[model samples]
Target: MMIGSSNKRLMSDINVTPFVDVMLVLLIIFMVTAPMMVQGVNVSLPETTAQPLPSEKEHLIVTIDQKGQVHISNYPVAMESLRHKLSKILEGRSDREVYLRADKKIPYGNVVKVMAEIKAAGVEKLGMVTVPIDETPADR
Candidate 1:
């Protein structure tokens, strides 16, 4: 108990037990909650005058960007392969429907090209997703 004795030296090692415990707790929490997270493909949908589409149990989503980049379920696909991919996907489920999410800035020709590919796949029912244009603040 001397005032400045070597035995009274302060502890130099960081106490990591508390930190390790917290990390373990967080790991367990994430493990338990991870599967509960709903995953979705991101795309900027164009606006439409049609009524809102109803939700479905399972549906395929295809996105076309302004630069004419095509993505199926977030996986990028080339124009040459789009037809084959669409055909393969539509072959598995004969009655399955597809939702097309094309950006507003995309050229009409590009959108039409994607539609043509889907039509060739024999997907009878196709839906275009759009975001409603919000009115101006003054109008609101």
Candidate 2:
């Protein structure tokens, strides 16, 4: 019988496949929940058949609740200060566009008044945000 001694070393390479898999799983979870995680002022938007607006850049969102309360980017602003506040927010922005999201239950006069204030704040373009009308027919 012959006995031989061989030199063998343990593996030094780290296995990163598990780490990469966990990272990818976390990324997918965040991506799936990202849209649902967006917090904003609550308002039931009116339905409309109007065409969607061309959006090339971000626009300041002005929301009005059912109680006639005004909010600029989720922060509540008094009606009297809306113009100045909006102007301050829009300063240095060249787009000069604002989108209004108001509750459908609000009076038309209040909406018009808010629009006037937005216009007075030097907003060149004012866009109204509305939910799309469903065209499906109901069966009798």
Candidate 3:
């Protein structure tokens, strides 16, 4: 009787291909959904020919929906108490600038009322957020 023994060492190198594939998939998923994660009060801004504001620093945002609802950031605020709430939010802040975004369907009177409240809150500069109008060379 003869016994034969074959010598073969087991593979020791770790496979990193799966790890890299998983990381790439996660990156793609985040990129695809990142814009959807931006939290803010939704409003259809009016179109204008005004230039876009330069973003030098963060400013507080006040949103007014078509239903005449006021919101500070993402929280809902009563129109009557808008001034007090804004004052609280702007307490001790040197830059008294606030950006207002209101739906195009909102009435002019409502917007003016909201603006008055903002002014009463001691906001020095008021910025109205509007969608830029696209113009062709022929329109210019």
Candidate 4:
């Protein structure tokens, strides 16, 4: 065998097969976990025909479940302390806006009580969150 004529050759091309495999795995993982990532208190919202309001930034959301438990985001808050908690949360915020989500089965009086507490906290604007009315053919 000649000294300079070796069978082994230098490989300058990159092996992209492993990279593509890793990327596909990551994509599948995200797809599988995406729907499970939705975070909120479960409540059957009242249906409405009103247009949805545009959201520019993250705002405070107060939710009341069917069992009448109050929540700020995902944390539970007692009705008695709602005003104090809201005030403390909005102490430095300029907008002082809040959104309320209540179960449709909840009594109107309970909803009014929560609204009163929100107003007492000095909130400037209060928005109600409702589900859009379904326009499916079967419903009609």
lDDT of each: 0.78, 0.89, 0.87, 0.92
Report the C-alpha lDDT of model 3 over 1-140, residue by residue, as the tens digit: 44786667998999999999999999999999998777677677887999986787777999998788999886889988999989988897888999999999999999999999999999999999888778443432
**Model 2, residue 36: C-alpha shift (Å):** 10
Q: Write the per-residue lDDT of candidate 2 for residues 91-133, one digit (tens) a residue.
A: 9787899999999999999999999999999999998998778
The positional error of residue 129 in candidate 1, measured at the CA in angstroms, is 1.1
By lDDT, the better pick of 1 and 3 is 3
Candidate 2 deviant stretches above 4 angstroms? 1-37, 135-140
Indicate whether candidate 1 or candidate 3 has the larger TM-score.
3
Q: At residue 66, what lDDT does model 4 achieve?
A: 95
Please give the lDDT score for candidate 1: 0.78
Ranking of predictions according to TM-score: 4, 3, 2, 1
Give each model's clash number: 0, 0, 0, 0
Candidate 4 residue lDDT tens string, 1-140: 67788778898999999999999999999999998776678888888999888878998999999999999987899999999999999998988999999999999999999999999999999999987797443442
lDDT of 3 at 58: 79
List candidate 3 segments past 4 Å from native: 1-37, 135-140
Question: Higher-lDDT candidate among 1 and 2?
Answer: 2
Clashing pairs in 2: none
Candidate 1 Cα errors over 4 Å, as ranges: 1-42, 135-140
Ranking by lDDT: 4, 2, 3, 1
